[model samples]
Target: MDAGILFWKAFCENGESELIDLTTIEASMTDSVVATLPVINPSTYTKTISSPVVVIKSEYRRYHHALKASNEAMPINLLYGWGLIGYWGGVMFLGTLWKVGQWFYYLRFNKSKAKDIEKPNQSSQGELALPKSLAMLRHWILLYIVIPATIGTYHQRLFWWSNIPNRLDSLIVFGFWALSIILGFAGYDTFSGNPTVTSLPEQNWEMLSDRTAILSYACLCWLWMFSGRNNIFLWATGFSFQSFNIFHRHIARICTIYAIVHSIGYTVEWIVYYPKYFKSLKENWFIFGIVATIALSIMLGFSSVFLRQRSYEVFLVIHIVLALVVIVALFIHTSYFGTQYNGYLWPTVAIWCFDRFLRLVRLVYCNFSVFSGKAKTTNASVMYSSASDVIRIDLQPTASSLKGRPGQFYYLYQPYTLRGWENHPFTLGAFTNGFEDSSPNTPEIVKKKVTTTTTAQLSDSSDDAVKLKSYRSSSLSNTLTFWIRPYDGWTKRLRNECIKGGGVCYPKILIEGPYGHTQMLHTYDSITMIMGGTGIACAVPYVQDFLGKSKIAISYTSKIKLVWTVRQPEFVEEVCANDLSAAICDQRIEFEFYCSKKNVPTNISTSVHSSDEVTKQIIIQSGRAPVASLIAESGTEAKLSNSRAAVLVCGPAAMADEARAAVHQALKNGCRTLDYFEEAYGW
Candidate 1:
């Protein structure tokens, strides 16, 4: 029967298992041998040696779990597991606290003034939708929470040693730190009392196990909250999953290092220095741990930024496969070790499963709808703007209603775009429910349209209201629009398809999300949007949403400014003509257009269009934007008039850096409370 026993018999008879030291390891029938040995690495079977004595298990009943088994401090180690529970709760607590303050600030500053509201339009709509800003939390968090925690976590370690070369060095140092925490492990030494015998070194295995329990718990946030749509992270931070990805990678690095160190400590103690170590090496628990660690290491390597950027498809494929393997291997590993660690592992599994379920539900809801007694996927009409190198797609929603806010991006999937599950994220450009809300589908030289509604009807008539609502609902397209700039892979493929036809292609597409932004722009008393080239996709939705509310004199966003820098004027040439007219007509808004190659438009400062006492015009200029002057202008206006101001920049890295510097300078000069936000694509 027992394989271990058979191995022992075989070894005694023919020396088949030569790896194990059979001479030193006596299969004793006696009580025990109280051997005096050096205390090196301690496990559960171990205790604090009075002087220098190793308690080696001589009696054996169960084959696998028989080696040096001890139930010492089981209750104590279980208590340590609760430390991980505290860590998860702590992060969630902070998120809730910060979100509370953001709500307060947004409600206080941005609201309709009542003076700007036109009497005719005010009664038609039920209420103006002005979502509050959650963006303000970052400013306070960056200074107080992030800065202090970062300093406390790593700064002290800097002074511990010097001459750190790079990030790799930091990872190695952290690994070493993980190893050094196991005290009383100062290399193997000979036992003078029992000169002939050698035993496994004693270490603080209890401490090692306790620390890693907390670490694995910390990692669950990255696995669940960072990627999941319905996570506490989204509610607390009010930012897209894109914004939280970086923090996920950082925490993952720490978690992996702890896991590797955990495996190493066990291997060194039981398999390396212990007498007759080969017997213990044949155990299943030790081998499962090794497999789990290797799988974790492979997953981390493939998920690195380099691999992800070079080829996302390959990274995603291998990443999921390796993650699955790690999960299965850990199930075996922990189940064998005992379920004390399942407090972390089981919850991680549950979170991952729930997230996948939500994703599947979202896909079906977005793509499937009943049309004429049959379920079908919605077809999207794609139109290419040759002048701007941007493709605008108008998607008819399957659902009766479509809703999204600024800064949210959707994962777009086209059947013919590429092969094997290819999806790209693009910002929500602009959308409309009815013709009144519908932006004019204009192409070439932004045009203007002026209409004076002189329909004089009683403001308090329910019949007219019902008629108006019914009429608008019948004509509602519920269109979801997105502007995608042509690039490599999917974009280039779509470009070729468009060029082959008459600048348009109607492809069946699937939509996955209506994600959220960090904060509502209405929170700021004054707001400036700096956009470079195609980065306007991120800003356009906010502009359109605010413009609608601004026309009816909605909420607190009174002073709005947009700074657009293009390589050539033709970049915006094919844009709707009405968009230009509407933007220029709004007195509450100002525009600064900079064209690098095109000369200044003749109407820069000479003439202005006036309709019904509203006068506005575009400020045309040559070359790049004057960042210093623009920022100085913002600061002066905020100090003189507004109590608070915000700058939102979505552009190339260089442009964003410039905007950030200017915003920083304004704050340093003691201007009104100014906050800066940028939308970057580094992920």
Candidate 2:
């Protein structure tokens, strides 16, 4: 008998259902197969039993090493996953500390009486020195030096890469990629004498394929974590959705790279070593993995900045569909492993479900009321301004608990339209408390008549009466306003509808959020806002909040300078006449308007009359706004006054970049206690 068959016979004869002692079986099989086999069948088994024994041992050792390699690879894969979690946890911890410090700072200011408040300069030298120096160091190191700076000659690309993140973000991404590469190749053991894999190169390829596949699975968890609009990371860290968005794109790239490598490694290994390559291509696991990899590549291609900028709605649809395909394909691709690896995948589904649940909660809370008995929904009064090419929407939600704050935004849905499921994010321009019933039954003529009568009353009334009227309207209104620049798609459609309805229409609108972190601008002593066009939506709320807090005697901001740049002087007039009427004549606020139109005169002055019967003269300068000089002047004034200043910029890419560069130079030039905030419009 052959040595291999004889060894099996001895193991079976010992006990088929019980565990055989390898030492006893090997001792019996070696003597029986080696000493007795040659005498019984000398023609076939003439060679010594040493050769068959060695072959059996070599096969057993190869199987042992394969199992050991798989066992060792698992914990390393888990460690890579845990490493990602640890990195984000550290970031959130720092953010939590900053949040707690901010809370205490605000608490101290809130408790102090207005009369007892000390001026910035009156604070003791010792108390100010440490904080001021720390502020300078933080701005110099993190904001100016690390965060905004880019790699190499990518200064101009900053404008193009506005959709991407800055230098610090790149460094973090590179670090993650480097770590993954190291883990993918490291700790893999390959032996030349293995029976399963004849060559060292073949074993190496098989191990590489296995490691990359598992690491890719590990990365999928984070990919989904960063893709949500309702990310806990955002809540914990107080970072913007934009910041996590950059993280999402980079992670997707990394995961896709791993998947590609995994697929290629297996392909090469099968073609070179295994003749069953063509047959394996028909297997369910192989087919689904190829589908997943292709789906991911498609998603990456369509999610480019150029493609997104061209048509966001289309990109959004493609992204959603392909995301589902990739998830499902990946789930099926790894299902052959049963539940061993599915732990990483199910969390992605759970996260997505949780995000959707919160979105539904927000939507229901913001748009519907239990007491209204399902009949009432959020309503919006939309009006189009031809002079400014802007749409003004005053949305009145049924739920009063939904409040607005500076830097918060909402996703608006026009449910009556054909594409009612489509929603767009707009900054919450302003919100007030009493309802204005512009129901569909209300006539446009009646609305015009009421507006004319109010204007007449305001013109004839005394300053106190006008102020009282302004105060009453503002205090008693229950509406949230969103200023929409009439771009393409939904905004353009809204404009057309408003125009068709004689410059105004009442549409059924649904609001889904009050998302985004509120800027703590009131903590600063001086605020300089540089707004361009519809960017004023970001500035108006902060101004209103400051004025409102001051009215309650809790405001920390002493002075606010608003520098607005618009293409049309008419747009400036329109906004100042309405949304900004409260701050127009306020003594603490200063306004500068720049009209960047060829037809507009360089030295034109416009008088904006507030409801308080106060006339504020706003000079509109022609040509582009001197953004750098404005920022420099604000920093210089704040430094001279020994006050903490904040520079807020929200505008076109060119203007924002200019402001960023200006702030960087100011910090570099020893402008202490100055902080910069940017509200980018990129989605």
The most accurate candidate by lDDT is 2
lDDT of 1 by residue, 79-161 (tens): 43344434445555755676776776554433333443454223211233223343345444333332221222232122232
- In candidate 2, the residue pairs with backbone N, CA or C atoms under 3 Å apart (3 or more residues apart, or in different chains) clash, namely 433-477, 433-478, 434-476, 434-477, 434-478
lDDT of 1: 0.56
* Candidate RMSDs in order: 11.9, 7.4
- The local distance difference test score of each candidate is 0.56, 0.71
Worst 10 residues of 1 by lDDT: 450-459
* Model 2 misplaced stretches (Cα beyond 4 Å): 1-70, 111-137, 143-147, 151-164, 191-196, 372-374, 434-477
